[model samples]
Target: MSSDEIALSPSSLAETLRAGERVRVLDVRNRDESDQWPLGGGDVETTHLPYMKFVQAQAKDEIGDLAAEFDDGERVVVICGRGESSATVAEALREHGLDAVNLEDGMRGWARAYHAEELDADADGATVIQYQRPASGCLAYLVVSGDEAAVIDPLRTFADRYVEDARDRAAELRYALDTHVHADHVSGVREVADRSDAVRVVPEGATDRGLAFDAELVGDSDELTVGDATLEAMHVPGHTTEMTAYRVGKVLIDGDLLFSESVARPDLERGDDGAEEMARQLHRTLHERVLALPDETVVAPGHYGDDADPEEDGTYTATLGELRDRLDALSMEEDAFVDYALSAMPPRPNNFEEIIETNLGRGSVDDDEAFELELGPNNCAATAD
Candidate 1:
């Protein structure tokens, strides 16, 4: 079991995953940990084998069952919560004549491997940068128009990186915006604004949430300038009462109000009783506010999950027409759609209350606490199918 270092960094593993390499990831965390923070995607296959079970098998010296599952020739990688347990498991697996290497830094490392890529905006004068937090299903954007720019739904942890990207694009940071009162991740709008003298704009209804700190509040048809381009605000609720989508040229920077596969759930702030009412509002917002737009308009959502719209660079986006055609569920009758939303509501994201408080500036937590609250892919997309 003793040997020199045998580990794969998250980035190296990500490269292999992206290239469609036939790598098998053996996640050696317990059931609860694996369920809460599952890994392994792209072209990599994952098998859950708890380290404790593997250790017990090693103690018994009857490795037949364990040995039969994995091929000796295939590239097998071991991962734990943070790589400590996986190293031991890898060592044990190696003793059984299997080529297994521990994943360096494990799931924590995976969380930080957010690949920020530029999105090709058919909007003539605008440059949109998509900050894809692959581990958490969070998508933030930096929209640059001429020399001015707007920052949207940014994470608090990556504030500096967003600023640096703005400088790299040579766009003067002018506006910092939050689509709504986020219930998952802390907003970077405050930091982004403080660093660049950018005016922070929250959706008009957000003021009703009793949030203390604020700058500008925007509502329907309210125009905000981004250099040569204009971003008109659309009051699209149902995710939250405050949900607003910004129309930048032909692109709808839709908030949690709409996603690629599913629309936002109605019961987070409302609970079950108010869900019906919220669902009705959602119907109006989509049928009246959002779907009323031209089919050519591009929908850039607040986040994306596994079944998101596919693209060459792993960016999640779709044209209104494409989605309207593909997602037949979106076109359901009003009564059916409301019933569907209420009935199909999934479990809320972990620590949503604390996350919402932090976003509202009513509660405060350090970086580590914030990270813990916002871990795993966002469950905000209602009925992920």
Candidate 2:
């Protein structure tokens, strides 16, 4: 809506990071929103300031505070879930005489362009887990152990490359996708499964994607053994009814529900009433369930966005403690949080209906058709939560 802002391109952010300039990143997304997913990048200096706080404080009022910690003319990058909201804040900061720029493309754009490090599958180097971010914020996991591995949530566009990466790791692609149904991009799960006939496991609750054979419909606490690495599915049904988080060693594959510093959208299933219930469920899971786990767990989320990191043109992985401290909605009173979440709901994915139908065996589209159906920058939510 505002055009007076100077938004930094992903390339510029990368350059700044490489140059080792003194930069401070301001994240404008709410805390609860950031908890489930976070920006991607193995490197980037970031700061978190929810948009409402930025809007209320005004850059002029905050410059003095930052000046106490930073020198004038030092680079400052501002970001939100998407780049739109942060663009407004960046303009305000620039007006206040600071060298601030919005990270163009945001976490979503960066994910498509960067390579992130992976978690160890066994806490031992014997099993290695690697991941790549592509197609906005969708994270593809390559779980390797004993010359065999599998990928999770691989987007259609990266399907071939994902297979190649597995081979490069000297692992046969044996299994994939046993977790949540994606809302933003159509998944390569069914395609990969169909292509290699690898065992693809999904939850029984998935009625949307008409997924085919060698599929195991798992439930809460169900354990999936992948080359000595055990993946335990923890059913966390807030983002979608079928949303499931994977517990692989000390890290959690938090599907859309949790981020490194944010939470994914919870209204993908339609109905404001349903979304309200989901918000409550998410709160319970965050405080009662996830919090109960060991605090040191590394959180690898399903989606990461542009605003997750402003200094780098990419999003990244984060620890559980980082998210619990941010993503504000997760900390609010249940009713109020639900209201906030629903009020900010963005338009659902364009082909969500088709994706659901195809996953549920109700719709039929071939591989090429699926790729066309799946590829795109995610525009569903106005900003990341």
Candidate 3:
């Protein structure tokens, strides 16, 4: 079969999955790698079959195992580390009359296709829209109140979409804020600011990060007001000394300070020297400052890892009571908390340095180059073990 007929673009594949259509995803990675970081989204069914085994069961150099697992003409998307190997596998599967297609650019291509799900509705004063970059679990928020809106921790590749979101909501874009100088995807703060007339806001503590652009700095007690929405900035200096979480009514834009399922790693920006100190700061930030908030307060954090599933209500959120009851990180004593926080972490996200530079306005890349630099899921959390 020709390459054109046997290849599925990531866009088309994402659409199929989002539409709740049945499409079997055959991942040809080694079994261990799949176990370590499984590919999952919503309810999509994925199967792991190492490349060698897949070809070994083929009769007379033709695919038989896949045919046995799936009916003839069943749609399947084959994926490997890079885009190349999957094409070969798709070609092999097609010889057996299955409608197999190679996933374009493989997993990396899939990572760049971000989709948003609105988190707040029908409640009271304001609303929040969550942009979930499913693969990396990097989340951006569109917090709206009356006629004004705030775009926080926007992903670099999807900045314009946020501006469009503001327009769609019939709100004037008032502020573009970053939780901290991100070490994952590029920050779209400048993109949001440049696209509209919004002001840029960063943490007062970001002086250490040496951001190049001018911005209003907010620290604990300093608040940002947009119409009836008053977001109080809380200086929670753990993940980064500069990371800020905004208090909007019951919602805390918790940044990287806390996650609904796990805690942020402390070693990324500090390297090895300041691991202990960073962990201590993180502990205090969670215990002394953040834990003081009301138990009913809802936390909306910056990034999420692979296993987090949004609630059936379509919101990725948790109350202080829920997190306090469920989150293991909250129960640790000072020393254990520090030790756990300083433990081994996953490898940094791809092009993390470049992403920080761009976010700081000290570096630039073309759109294509930016997307290439940010082609995979963000490894922004610590390893479970």
Candidate 4:
């Protein structure tokens, strides 16, 4: 909270970066913790270091090597869930005779302070794709084709930028909607679609209550070619009956059905029903369908929220070849995966109902209204299992 003081608060760290100061973000949380809840991207350069591991142990032995990675006198801002762990790391770095500043309030405070940015607009060429890293743990995308682009879960006002990006890319923005629905920040799919002349496209089997659209009612293996890429619709129902995965080339746009590597939480919609359903579906999909693809295919998933393991973010982009070799669901018998999934799930966010309604054009709020409600990055959701 202090400015002149050498130590920095997360809010102040944000302010300093805004002022064009160079700061290095050092995360000291454990590998698993970082995976579930990471610090979202913003105005600073961040380097991750799991607490008391090879990276940390080596920091002392190679202070010069570590210091060489940074500019002379660059303020090193270390962080973790609470300030204590980061503070300790900073002290060690400082004692090693390097200029470093511990980030006060740490990761939690950072999530509370800085806002996420929309990096690429018109991301998927003429289709107009926009990317958002919201609530530290969640990643949402909006893509448009012609006068119609689909919005998967949206995180911030970044939705507006997504629309603008579509315009810049010379596409007529039409439809906005999520893959199934969401449990994190209220989905702004409809909020954004309404901002333009777009309709909302709910997956064919999802709940429908008279929403207007160029209804793209699809079934298993049905594919839609938007812009230059083809998004194949795979009806892999486990996380939810309506849950679908959109595949383009080797890249699978796996909504909550698949994460960087792990399948998404199934407990939200089904509760106890979810655990059994997810396990069964996961076994079939992973062993028979997904893993059946070429090992080199790339995988991009939906819902990387507060529950993801941060240490795995870089490696999150796993190849079909790699995923097949490493997937736990594949090795486990169906019953085991069901039990494991139930035990691993975090509580779904308290705002899922609101998010679903909002995405379905039933909620009462604008994009700005929803963005303000989700300023802090918290993307953890516990489903029905």
> Number of the top candidate by TM-score?
1
- Write one digit per residue (lDDT tens) for candidate 4, span 45-67: 66777777625566558755655
TM-score of each: 0.93, 0.66, 0.86, 0.63
Give stretches of model 2 more than 4 Å off: 1-116, 120-135, 207-214, 310-315, 379-385
TM-score for candidate 1, residues paired by index: 0.93
lDDT of each: 0.81, 0.64, 0.78, 0.57
**Sorted on lDDT, highest at the top, how do the candidates line up?**
1, 3, 2, 4
Cα-based lDDT at residue 291, candidate 2: 73
With candidate 3 superimposed using the best TM-score fit, by how many Å does residue 318's alpha carbon deviate from the native? 1.1
| Decreasing TM-score order of the candidates | 1, 3, 2, 4
- The sequence of per-residue lDDT tens digits that candidate 3 reaches over residues 113-160 is 677777653323778888877666788998888889999998768878
Candidate 2 lDDT tens digits, 19-75: 445557777778755543444333446677787776666645764464344346677
Model 4 TM-score is: 0.63
lDDT of 1 by residue, 82-164 (tens): 88888887877777788889888788877776666666657547887788776777889888988788989988878887778
Comparison by lDDT, 1 against 4, better one: 1
TM-score of 2: 0.66
